[model samples]
Target: MTTTSVRARFLGDGRIDFERATLGPVANGQVRVRVDVCALCGSDKRLLRSGSPVVPGHEIAGTVVDVGADVTVPVGTRGIVYIPVFCGTCRRCAAGRTNQCLHLRELIGWQRDGGFAEHVDVPARCLLPVPDDVPLDTAVLGLDTVGTAAHALRLWQRTQPDGVDRALVIGAGPLGLGVVAVAGAFGVGEVDAFDPHEGRLATAVDLGARAAGDLAAENQYDLVVEVSGAAAARETAQRVVAPGGAVIALGESDEPYTMPATPRWRRTDCYTVRSFYFPTSEVEANWDLLRDHGAALRDRLTVPVTLAELPDAFARFVAGDYFKPCIVSEDAP
Candidate 1:
């Protein structure tokens, strides 16, 4: 069966074009989803600037409407699309580290056609089933916002077995706000956040983080999460972290991550934990986190718009007029 759907295409130099795409039958080992909500991410800016070869909306939540041969996931099952297409047979995958799969090559939005359309075909294994009680919009945050934040904190716990006393988050964007929202639940104490944009920083404060007084202060926070891809933010994270503390690098950048050979940098002894998206093993736990904090986050971060309004939504997103703009399907419940 073939389906025609309206999807967004990114043309280079900050342009978006909407076109009707003819999607062929679901390939074997795949499932076709009717996208209910696809949230804009900061990472999508890179694709918007450079233009993507495939459709580009990664933080996705939808309902499975069609299944390929041999797939057990029933139609009408709600799920969030896991971006990393991991090979299930790999040792890392066998250990439930799907994000760290040894054979990971393509991310759904980056390398393959993603959820900027009404329907998207993805690997059956990449569908994370949503609980019946969770709303699709709230469940979508499990992909990048709350999911990644929780994963980073979980990994940081390994470095500091006791607990995080004071946590600092640089960049109060969607993900940074996510960390702030879940920090207390993760046992982090006295969370503080910084962002150059006052509006975003205020949002972080609304999410339970204190406004950072000074970015220049050193050796203050026990855990510093760097969520902005800016080089300066990375430097700030390295500087503010205490000697025995850990810096969780969750940001992505095209610019090289540099460790300056300053005397302070040379003497400090700290663990730098870099984390990717959450592993499938953590999905159940993440759902709990979402259930506790997801609604507030959705209210603060997401501004829902129709599929036809996607280009305008992205325009506002680029202008910082919207925090996280979501393309919502008309039929979404």
Candidate 2:
């Protein structure tokens, strides 16, 4: 039998070229989803800078159109694709840290063909069914933006038994705003957000965090979450972290920097500093977080664009025109 054909896009230097590709039979334990929407992520900027040679959209939501043997989710189920592809038998996977699997293969958006097309195949184990009430567009951000923030917050909460006194999130981008949105949900008493961009800072304030122009607080915050991936932000996190406070660094820096900068440390300071990744097991809870916040939050936090406008949308993203750009199918509501 002839294979079905689907439209796919390949990335170039800030440009996208379209192609028609054949969709093969679904492999065992896999599902083919007709993508409804794919939210462009903060990390997608890395792809943009590198000329994003591969199909790249990790924050994906769609309807399952086909499924192979052993897959229980029926066809036509609305769902979101979990981006991290892990070896399920690894020790980390056993401990529920699939994101840290010993043999990490491809991340769906970066290393594999992702949801920048009419259809994409995903491992059934990586698929999470979207609840009926959750919009596919909002569901897209649940996979990465909110998921990662919730993961970071969960880790940060482990260090604060008495609850956080003041939580500061650096960068005021999607993830940063996410940190502000959910910090109080995680027992943070007061939340503050810092960003250089006034527009983003205002968005942060809208998300229930007090906005700050700079990270000049001297040892005032009990928790500081750094999401900017900028050298200066990391340096600022070090400066503002109170003694016994913790810093969760989620962003990646382009240049190498000396860890344990002597200037930012004091002899008696005891703090925990660590990097965080998405939690594959937390999909349901992450979806719940978005659902609980509802459309008022989702609408202010995200905007939808058609896939054809993705390339230009990305350009506008870099120019600071949109906060969260979600690419949706023409038929998506």
Q: What does candidate 2's lDDT look like per residue over 268-315, in tens digits?
A: 264555645676777768877888764545687677888778778888
Residue 179 Cα positional deviation in candidate 1, in Å, after optimal superposition: 0.4
Q: What tens digits encode model 1's per-residue C-alpha lDDT throughout 140-253?
A: 999899999999999988888778778999999999999999988777989999999999999999888898887787898889999998999999999999998999998999
TM-score, candidate number 1: 0.98
lDDT of 2 at 75: 89
**Candidate-wise lDDT, in order:** 0.92, 0.78
Please estimate how well model 2 matches the true structure, expressed as its whole-model Cα lDDT: 0.78
